[model samples]
Target: MQKILLFTLILFGIDSIFAVTHFLQYVYSGSSGIPNLPEFMTVGLVDGEPFTYYDSNIRREVPRQEWVTKAVDDDYWDRNTQVSMDTEPVFKNNREIAKQCFNQTGGIHTVQWMYGCEWEDETGATGALHQFGYDGSDFIALDFKTMTYVAPVMQAFPTKQKWDSDRARMDYLKSYFTQECIEWLKKYVSYGKSTLERTVHPEVSLLQKDPSSPVTCHATGFFPKGIVVTWQKDGVDIHSDVWVGETLPNGDGTFQIASKLTVKPQDWKTNSYSCVVQHKSLQDDIAVLLEEKNIKRTNQGGVSWGIIVGFVAAALALVAVVTGVVLWRRSRTGYGKAGTSDTDSENSSQQQPKA
Candidate 1:
């Protein structure tokens, strides 16, 4: 059984784990109340997929082309590069770099990047902070605080032997980000917390994992992220035989999830199950009563949401593999390990187990 499981996991490359090996972000924002400053805009790339661009002025995320179009249409000359290089040149470079980085870092952990301005009103001070990093560590930082550019991943010049290396270009970037870019941010950019306030109410439904498995309370379309869903039985919470799938992005501005709970024969036959959806957008915790009609509706919606909720399905399978196999073995041997049932919370393998 173990060998079969291993082969299955390797055959499909464990679809969920093979993807999203690394994370990359490109964020640009300026302090609020500038003359013509742009909004806090962020573009993120994952596994070299389509870039998701977000602007503070608008609530939802748009395609990267929207940001590119704005950059081209507005001429974006208001952004200053400390070097003689113009805005268009740097903009083009940023776009290409993001694409290349995604393609190259197919197996890395994480990559974070930023190209934006930071300002202080009371101090009447401004600076441009444009840099990117690997994992959670800072590989490069071109910021105003130190008045310098440093790549933590790279060694600085001490012997003066590496003067002609990439450090030369970094020095110039430090110059541009601090002076010219700072001026542009001060003169043309502003920041607001609008995205935090954007919210979308969720649409909830309940579905059976399979013909015989536990039921899943799936919620989608809630926005501003960070929503939680849980299952209740007979006005009380039940954790045994529950699998809370990861909350995944809807690729739009919203998010979705599937939290599954085992329904014994009695509960399914008696109609005593309920799902509670919670989000900041809603005034109160929304309760979804599970009944014959709801389950029928879920049956009707089969495989349609599969495209978007594929990850959740994979997650359910992983939960079963990681738990079911252990339980089966234990039952066969009539011996169970301590804390065995809670392996779902302990297993952090990036790969999703094949059902």
Candidate 2:
């Protein structure tokens, strides 16, 4: 009986240790100040592992199994390197910059900057400004404060991996801002919306030739987890013959989502086919046109083919007349003799008659 009790106690002790470990591994705390510390600290765990504390005055990481401090210099935290907190002004400026950048390049995927209102220092004069944009494949960064451009940050991992990494970064940034900054910039940054931008590749193959036969389109893209995909005809939502595939996570961190839909060929021909994707922060719709056999001509009776033919004929005649005049001029020499044989007898008679 005593042996059984001892074994039970040992099991309970092991369970308690595991519970405590799990709690400590995932614990997070953020505040204005910490006791016995000169500067405030924002502490958190990364994937159940403890890391360093981040704050305005002191940015340092706690060493594992050692009493060492990894300190970050104040100069390294450039106040001008930050984004602006004035939502309207920042958004307005950002939109303009984004449009210019997109026009110069093609499109942008991400934009980052330090907030003016959320400046760590009381001066509110400086903050870091970073912008990230993409041209379909490669990622690019721009520093607004320095007006400097960085080289493209190539996506090293597959689409899924890239998405996951971005998600982690966004999550970390949100937590960091909420804890460290006096004013939360997450509401204005559009980080959630930017992360939701995705490109879907869809292929459609004709299944049947009948007018009533349904035409289908398939799409696949790397998107954030929990995104919703829907099919639309023209501007209206569609619910017929839709198939949504399972979203798979990429090894690095992102996810791949696929979906398919079928609609009447006639409807597809007359209306636009679209895929609308939705996420917590962003919403976008992509569409493809369905080929139409019958289309109305806009210019009904304005111009006729006969008029064009007549104009061309007149132009050709004018060219022919000009060509004939050129040939005639070339054929006649300065003496006005062109292949006309002037017999010696005739020439002599003419000369004598004239005398």
Candidate 3:
């Protein structure tokens, strides 16, 4: 089960395992017919925290973090800006090519390219991803194990063939991802070590909307982005009647998570129920008892404003993460799938794509 969970995490490129694994992702999005938004945009995230941003509107690669501004020299920004400028046209062209392949003449459309490398600090292991999506759906991805591009749709066949014929490009991608990307990732991690490596304990809250609503165990303002929230009934773990929330980012760069457990008032009154939180920074798990006095009830009078503010902050943080990544794929509709898309997150092999 541990191995399975680890594999799942590697596949999704989630930095949820404390500080053992660090990721460097560059998500490029090009869209048409979208008003009040950049036609082309690229964001660089280190451990799910955006450190650099580049959009067609800005026309420049800018640092998003103070540490990034201090750690890198002017040449660094100039080189990246030039590289982004050079890559902008390619993405625009790709977007059109993708649209044409999908028989899309007009209306809103998007082409997304997310590529990145991940490094395991403890094991000295690494992984990489290079995938493209048309209208926010999987189009093609380079399978490192087969050393070939896997097309998830018929429209992507031409792209696969073109890229497959270019053995030199495949080799370059392999070398760049495994060697150059890792070196840069290490440098960036080192540059932002003080900010990235530091751990902050989570602030937990038990909340309820009404008398019959399920209780929510919310932990916010935590760092390292790793935590576990569980429900305990009479000291045993309760799995059913529970809904676990995604680990979300806070405005202050910390992280938050929530778990909801359903139970009747009579049951909780007779049995001891608690919300247990486990984090790396804590010496002991925090167990907040399920009681009326312990919970922040929204329907009740004299409610703590802090709890309401924190809940609002979580909502805003979710928006920030969504906009930062611009998860256009999930929002897409009626996009026909082509090839059998690999549901697995990361392509585990490190080999170059074969011709």
The per-model lDDT (C-alpha) reads 0.41, 0.30, 0.67
lDDT of 3 by residue, 1-355 (tens): 3333443464332435454887777766666787776777777777767788778888988877888886676688777777677666666666666565556788877666667777888888777767766665677777765668878667667667767777877788989888888888888888888888787888888888877888888888887777778899989998999998667656567777778888998999899999998877788999999988898885665334465456545533232233333343333221121121222122212222211
Worst 10 residues of 3 by lDDT: 334-343
Off by over 4 Å in 2: 1-221, 250-252, 280-283, 289-355
lDDT digits (tens) for residues 1-355 of candidate 1? 4323322232221312322111122332212233332323334332112234443345344444233323222323222211112222333333334335435423323222344333343444333334433322343443334434443332211111222244555466566545655553333222212332356788887776455666778888776445667677777876788887655555554567778777765666686778887776788888888775676334455534565555333322121121122122222211111111101111111111100
What is the lDDT, from 0 to 100, of the residue 77 in candidate 3?
Answer: 76
Candidate 1 whole-model C-alpha lDDT, 0 to 1: 0.41
Report the error of model 2 at residue 130, Å.
42
Candidate that beats the other on lDDT, 2 or 3, i.e. the better one:
3
- The TM-score obtained by model 2 is 0.23
lDDT for 25 (candidate 3): 72
Q: RMSD of candidate 2 to the true fold?
A: 34.9
Q: Give the Å shift of residue 286 in candidate 2.
A: 3.3
Candidate achieving higher TM-score, 2 or 3: 3
